[model samples]
Target chain A: MNDDEPLIRWQWIADHTAELADYTGIHLRLGLLPVLFGLIISVPLGILCHRWRWLYPPVLTVSNIMYSVPSLALFMIFVRYTGLTEQTVMIPLTLYTLSVLVPNVVDGLASVPEPVRLAATAMGFGAVRRVIQVELPIAVPVVIAGVRVAAVSSISLVAVGQLIGQGGLGYYITRGLQLDFPTPILTAIVLIMLLALATDALLVLAQRLLTPWSRNKVTSA
Target chain B: MIRFDAVSKNYPNGTTAVDELSLELAEGGITVLVGPSGCGKTTTLRMINRMVEPTAGTVSLRGRDIREVNAPELRRGIGYVIQHAGLFPHRTVLDNIATVPMLLGWNKKKARTRAAELLELVGLPAEMAKRYPNQLSGGQQQRVGVARALCADPPVLLMDEPFSAVDPIVRAELQAEFIRLQKELHKTIVFVTHDIDEAIKLGDNIAVFRTGGKLAQFDTPERLLAHPADDFVADFVGQDRGIRRLSFVNAAELPLRDGPVLPATAPVAQARAADEPWVLVVDEGRRPLGWASVAELADGGTLADASLTPLGHTFSLVGDSARAALDSALLSPARLAVGVDAEGAVVGVADACELSAGTTAVQAAAGEQASTEAESASSESRATVGKTSADTPGGGDR
Candidate 1:
């Protein structure tokens, strides 16, 4: 097979439509699970850091280390520890993202205007109630922005799960390189790129839906 | 009844906002805390509801210690209005006002109903309830702030520079609305402002605070204006205090001789008062129709035929401060302002000479002129207290 043959890849993709569906289902599950986990862990952690300033430097340092850890090295480190299993891959990807996500969540919330918070307190909102009612609502736009970035990042990272036993699009690329058949590999690359674009578009729609007030402000400005 | 007993606040940086200040806010009247900035006027007001906790002493509400109660719970029970209205931008006007009630777990329906009722009570229509804070004019937003504070019907209301955000015109309207509301609700209020005139206008008792959180003087507006505690209080209240006093006198309060009911056939000898140069002419019902000089009376002119510009009934109602009365007198064309009863009948006329002297002193002081004008006006008015100095054209209260 020709190394750069587009028609061969198109044929392979058409033949493997069912596999593509399964891949989509898997990619979606992998992408969303980590985000849901990150949101839960990071929102509370961010709030903790917000209430106590001393916690910020340490939390920021941990997040920065996670962010700077090369994805491929993280993959190898987890694989070496857990022996190339799917769970090993998923866990590291989720843990690695906490760095980017925790900071975003914290920064998203830290930016809520001082006057708005003051007004909330003056209105008799206790600490937790202020978090839920005022801070969360005001931080929605920035929080959603963080989620968008994290979701797209997770989708691209989870594709690397093919390095182990998981048969994701990353598996197809590895398969083609092993067998010297360019069709499966190029098919995987195109499909993954399309998935990334589609997921990003979906997140943008979600952001718009959740923050109409922000939308009005942006357009009016 | 709000009482501050030796209340003092020291910030974490060790700045003393209010230093051991004690004062009693009356049960159903407006007590104004007037001072320069950093005098702790605002800090004193905030301590009443525990927004700023007192570092040294207790602030009591109706004799109950604020410290003994839960701070948030106590705050929910006290209405707080701050400068710029401090409205929550994310919430609608109705939601903003309903904050305390919702915190107390009132059913949504009841809270919304209360918010709507309060919006109407503050002279805003119920339609304004759905708009957000950014959508409102400054004055409307401040009214909503007041409405929100009053939503829970807290017996003691604390307002800190509540009207400072609005222009003068709306401020006046809001002041009038506040006075009207106080008359009806009888809620005890502690108002803080740097504007001395606002304190004079709204306060039953005005407390003048000097810097370092020391209260210079506390007294009724009449006494405070008539006799300031020291040079500081006097300067702070402004130098034109005598003009501040004429507001106490009404046009009808001064002795007015009855006008002649001289019809076309009336006799000249019995028609006009001989002691007066100009006799007021009126119809039989004692309604002043016009003025006829003694020269016209010599021509046998009837009261109906006199040159009467409507006596421009200027009157000071009970409870209006000297400032408000001076303002009213200044606005009237008639130097002799008429004080009317609530029924609008002429109660009495203010002495034109006194009102002018009072107004001149205010103008002189307000203009930052030296005491020269005030001294001259005082002595000039003292010389003519018994005589109507009407010929000193255009100098009364205005």
Candidate 2:
């Protein structure tokens, strides 16, 4: 098959099926792991910042600044410190996830009604127990929404890591570009969007499962 | 029992919420803290559970300083209820009520059992246990709040405007139920309210705070109404305090006047002879059936054939207050209030004019009785006054 063949190169894709599967798997992990790790780190951090009113502004400002830093610049900064490996791509992607997630976690927890908090405290719920049992469960929907955004954005941004020789599905895009062939690039782009949608849907389903109470019409008690 | 000794809450900005308060609350009785906005009633109630710590002096439970105990531990043993119920929306009514018991480490079964019992105690149906707080009406939610606070049966309860969020009708119902429940539970309670009427209805002792957190007066509702200590207290109690005092005056001594009566079986001639403008016809049991007008009966018709006007109301001298007796007379179509015995048998009747004249004499007697009561007043006696039923006449004279 010629590298300059028409964009619908079915025979070439069929031949490289194993390689495509490997890159697809890598693409998913690169998008998903950072989200999982980011939630684990940011939710608690966000809650802590929420608990201490003075800590919120400073933490939010820092996260906002990190979020606004160009993704390519962030990736390059990680490369200088960690060298050309998966860590270079992963560390920056994870940071971006945290930047989005931390504020959502804080906002979600803050959204809990003041009366509910007072009720919990008056009923002898300790500070730690109240946060975990009452607040975190109530905040699930909002926090999960942030996770959905972070995951989709992370999946798209992982393709930029191809500049550092560590692309996931982005390997196909780079290869297509080098050979002046549009088929692989378009296929990879389409595949990336489908993957983002699938994962976003999964997060939404998880939110529904975790936050069953949010589905009801709630009036003030 | 709780005690506030020189307790004061002074904010860093130098505004005092409660100032140099010294008071002792009796065991198994309700002590209400009430006044206008920013009068520190809520602050005082919160101090009992240490939700707000006093900047100076101490709040002690059973003679031990609250500061000596851990706050969460102290609060666990002291139930707290607030306005709008402040229920956890995520939890079902059962779980919300079961909160304190669960925190105390009762097994789920036991905690839930206690919660069910409390739900019924607070007059909520058993089926409400599975419903979320948001599913309930405001009144029902307040009941759940009460049930939740009482789940662990803490000997002390602190309430801050717990029923104020409800409509007037529901508020009255809640207040009545609260009084009934207090009779059974006998928990020492500190209640906060801005409504003086509520304070009067529920409090064994009412602490009326003025602006700037000054304790203007602390007395029984009767005393507060009968003899307000200062101009501020008198104004706070309102100009209608005299009318409110009538609630404590029993009608047992009000003189009953006889009205012309005839049995339902009496002949038309006998019915006419017994009638003044209207004739009261009684059944064989001597229970009043209705009033028969002398003019309404045809010349040859029997008492049963006469057109009867329905009795507007019946008052009981045994349990009714002078206010109630007055209301009965005012509502009567014949301008007379009938007096009934325990069996609903007619005792006698008094027309509006007679009732007014009689009430003045009764009020004088009640005034004398009230003055005499101050020297030997006790909560036991006051409790009796609150639970007055037709079977147990509130007045000494019957």
Residues B180-271 of candidate 1: C-alpha lDDT, one tens digit per residue = 99999999888999999899879977888888888777766666776676778889999776666555443333333232333333455655
- Ten-residue region with minimum lDDT total, candidate 1 chain A: A212-221
- The native-contact fraction of candidate 2 is 0.45
For candidate 2, write residues B351-383 as lDDT tens digits: 766766776776677667765674355532332
Q: Lowest summed-lDDT stretch of 10 residues in model 1 chain B?
A: B389-398
Q: How does residue B254 of candidate 1 score in lDDT?
A: 39
For model 1, the stretches where C-alpha displacement exceeds 4 angstroms are A1-4, A7-9, A80-83, A165-167, A176-221, B245-398
Share of true Cα-Cα contacts across chains kept by each model: 0.25, 0.45
Q: Which ten residues in a row have the lowest lDDT in candidate 2 chain B?
A: B389-398
In the predicted model 2, the residue pairs found to clash are none
DockQ of each: 0.22, 0.46
CAPRI quality band, candidate 2: acceptable
